[model samples]
Target: MSLDVDIGHASGRGPRDLNEDFAGAVRAQPGDRRQGLIAAVADGVSGGGLGLEAAQTTVMGLLSDYFATPPGWEPTVALDRLIRAQNAWLADHNRRRRGEGAALTTLTALALQGQTWTLAHVGDTRAWLLRQGEQGPELSLLTQDHALDHPDQRSRLTRAVGLDDGLRVDFAQGEAQVGDTLVLTSDGVHGVLRPTRLAELAAWGTADLAARALVQAALEAGGQDNASALVLRVQGLDPRQLHDEQAWGRTLPVPSPLRVGEALDGLTVTARVADTGVHLLYQVRAADGALGALKTLHPSRASDPQERDMLAHEAWLGRRLTEAEVPGVVRVWPRPAHASAFYLLFDWHQGRTLEQLMAGPGGPPRVADALTAALAWTRTLARLHRLGMVHRDLKPGNLHLGDDGQWRLLDLGVALSGQENAEQRALHAGTPSYMNPEQWEEGGQADAGSDLFALGVTLYQWLTGRLPFGELEPYPRGRHRREPVPASRLRPDVPIWLDRVLAKALAPQARQRFETAEELLLALERGASRPLQPARALPLLQRDPRAALQLALGLSLALNAVLLLWLALWR
Candidate 1:
């Protein structure tokens, strides 16, 4: 059900006057599966009088800061950021006290999350993996020492924390399985004990007993240095999270198109919904007669790896949002154990999209209702932006109004959560009509500003049933020199204050627009009592480059013609 592990650590002074080795392990809070487990070992360089301080700080800093990073960040990204920051701080401290010995240490850290293990290492500190194989228990070294190859200089570290301004950390990742054992040690333990002897001790018993035995054996083997050992045995692995989506999509088979009355994985298809060329949607009924929405790739694009990855990412985002209890989003169901095909199952809500409501026989909702909905939606966007997520596609069609009177944001296939590969970010996503002007330019990428722009466009359409920029195609278009006709102009009932807010939201230049969702929300909350000041006008050139260019050409042409006429008269 969740990541399960047994961990223990031990350190002894051995023949040293003071123990300079530090080791620590921190497990994620119960039910916090995403944070996973972090364990580290640091061996303080003996020459440095502050060796104990360096070892303790490096190990403790990593244990605390790694969890503080954004949950959406990849393990490698988070570790690199924290390690680099710690290294910089320690290096600066050493520079300030130049005469004093530098606080230098060797660090080797490991993170076990879901079904994978990630390692970050430097100096001669080591990590090892012991696994039960068909042949027997095997021990494999997981990290290389950042030291010299020559026998004489083997103990001299080439890379270490606080050694210099620059730090080079080696990183490695591999699949983790139940019954696997991980071990971390300071050079004092591994330098004196042979691999075979270490492996025998590591396989002895409980993690705590095994770790103590390792330190004892190293000291008895005539090791004169401080000895430390940290051990962890995997008891179980958590369900694969977002990082594993690409691998899952690659291995799983894409199901053939299903028809009404057909059942796959206990869900019977009741009706085909929409086929958007890249994907297919279906209305299905569970065994208990509950309705659900199923989404899968269209048969034509079944072989496209990018499409599969995109779908998996969408599913992962949906699940993560739901688990976080993020409001205004649909909940995604876990994949069934007997799944014959790769598809996403979401809780079905009976609702009409904002687009449908705008086009219905009754026409768009009242101005007050639309404004209220916009306020609620903006709050949702604020939460998403705070989490470093951007809903690439935010339009009326993706905004749902449930029969239960709640609003939901849908279709996260193109959203960016920072884990997206460059290829995914470059894809031209979202409706052309709702997309901002910058997104139409070359090399443009979507961000929170883009989502806010789309929201403004959606609200504009909801109120007036018209696009502010007329019908914008995917290619180059006429420059928009003038501002959007105020919403009040299209609908007399729309208030001036609401129009002002929308104008700020729809500013063509990102600098002139509301940089955050919270700012837009505050404006809406103020309403007529505190109307926002009008935005400053842009220079003529920036207002409309096309128009400026045209005017220059026309003036030049007329001046040439006048000169020619004068010359002819003079002749």
Candidate 2:
């Protein structure tokens, strides 16, 4: 792999685009042992202050290390060092400007060493891959982003190259193909353009032209922020690399002339998960001999190169997330590409999915599981949201209760970028029952808040044993109204304070919802320890740091309630 970079930036409506993008692709030195890397980036930050300086300094510091020691660099270690270096440099730079404080900017960087490349990012910047398509072209998101809203934090940039003294870098490596085009950009580029249009642009022109074109299109489409992009093509020698790259995206051998009873490894077909999507849930035991489920594509159907590639990619992503120790998630197991089929092997969890529990027979009248499940549900959602990956489909069916007493969130089959991305409209992958009104009213993509809203629905169902707006049928005309039933009605013992919190989380407007699951968790955690009042919960949602801190001790709630009672008696 070689290197190339082109930068495009302009002033925002505020007169300056604090956002600055820096791109660098350094060819490996003669003594270098690994394949060279192709790196590119675009970073946009609020306040326009030193956001540009922070971004520029990061790439400069990273490029220096990258070119200095390409001879012995592993993707994981290199990326971590790069992020640490960037964070340290930024911290020093901020201390110097203590009078002005720190300026925040999102970072997305790509380093390709040989046929393999790793991506590291924080905040709204993004990375994506595009390969040749049978219908022309298709692209997949490589980095899920480190934004305020997912795997579910809301304060923003839980990890970034320059957000704080420490940088929490999200990293991954994948095989790059001959014609594979990798793209990195600040939130502004895809934030304004649609995904199909972005893919079309990348497919139609050279890496340089396509990247610039996408940026230009975004600006034309009323892009309100500074924008940038780095686009690169994989070339040069390595026949073996081509095979490896081709194999990365295929897993399960699609059944062909081969007999059905013939086993691949050890999985036996038990049933199908989704017929159209080629998702097969197989019965098997993991290498550790633990009972597990295996999901793979049908071999005959996997014959379609593009579909097989996608399934393989999905499996790869699944495994990566799982290994990261990011809680409440499942990851794909890595197996060599074979038979042009893709499959994901999972540790069969003993307990049923939350969805199964929701509709199970209890003779109809609803009983509340909200209190029992609230902590795990909110905490689990909070952890993932902090990592910047939304579960998109977050109904009861997708949440699993493991026999080990740990709650597991499964099936990120439709995860998408929350930052600016062209494919925002293409995120039509959620169970309608749990989907928020934004899905039908605006065709809006899922965000951390959106996931939280769905979670509120799940929490409600678990508590009330009823759907939010009556039962949602199939996708034809799935309806979600603003009228959410009070948690008290279904489970009358439910505290008024807790009900208020749920109502805010499921607020119809995104802004009104608890900014992060952490916020809701904090309230819930505090409320769980004390008897909070309903009248006080709304203000609690709006309170400053000190009031919330005081409330957390369980002291303020009682005092405030007594004061209210006194005033009511006086009146």
Compared with the true structure, all predictions reach lDDT values of: 0.87, 0.63
Candidate 1 lDDT tens digits, 1-571: 7788899888989988899999999988765535589999999985645988889999999998887777766677778888888899999998998687788899999988777788999899999999998889999999998899999998788999988888888988876889999999998899999999999999989999999999999999999999999999999888777756654565577878899999999999999999988899999999999899999999899899789879988988888888888899888887786577889999899989988888889986798898889988998899889877999999988999999998999999999988776678889988888888888778988999999999998999888989888877786475445689999988999988988898998876888899899999999999999999888878768988878998999999999999999999999
> In candidate 2, what are the lDDT values of residues 1-571, reduced to their tens digit?
2433232223233224344655555655665555565465646354545766767777766766775643333456666786787688777777787677675566777776545667777777778888886876689888776656654454266566556786677767676667787777667777677778878876656666776687777788877766676777665533222213334443235643223344556544443334444555656554455555666555556677655544543554455466666666654455533324445576666777777766678533233345547777788778777656676888877788777777788776566423212332264778777777666655566678778888888877777777777767545342432447788887777778778877877765566677888887887777656633443233543433445676776777888899999999999
Clashes of 1: 0
Residue 350 shift from truth in candidate 1, angstroms = 0.4
- TM-score of each candidate structure, all chains considered together: 0.65, 0.49
Model 2 spans > 4 angstroms off: 1-25, 28-247, 250-261, 266-277, 286-288, 298-310, 336-340, 362-369, 417-425, 472-481, 528-571
How displaced is residue 132 in candidate 2, in Å? 30
Of candidate 1, the 10-residue stretch with the lowest lDDT total is 242-251
- The TM-score between candidate 2 and the true structure equals 0.49
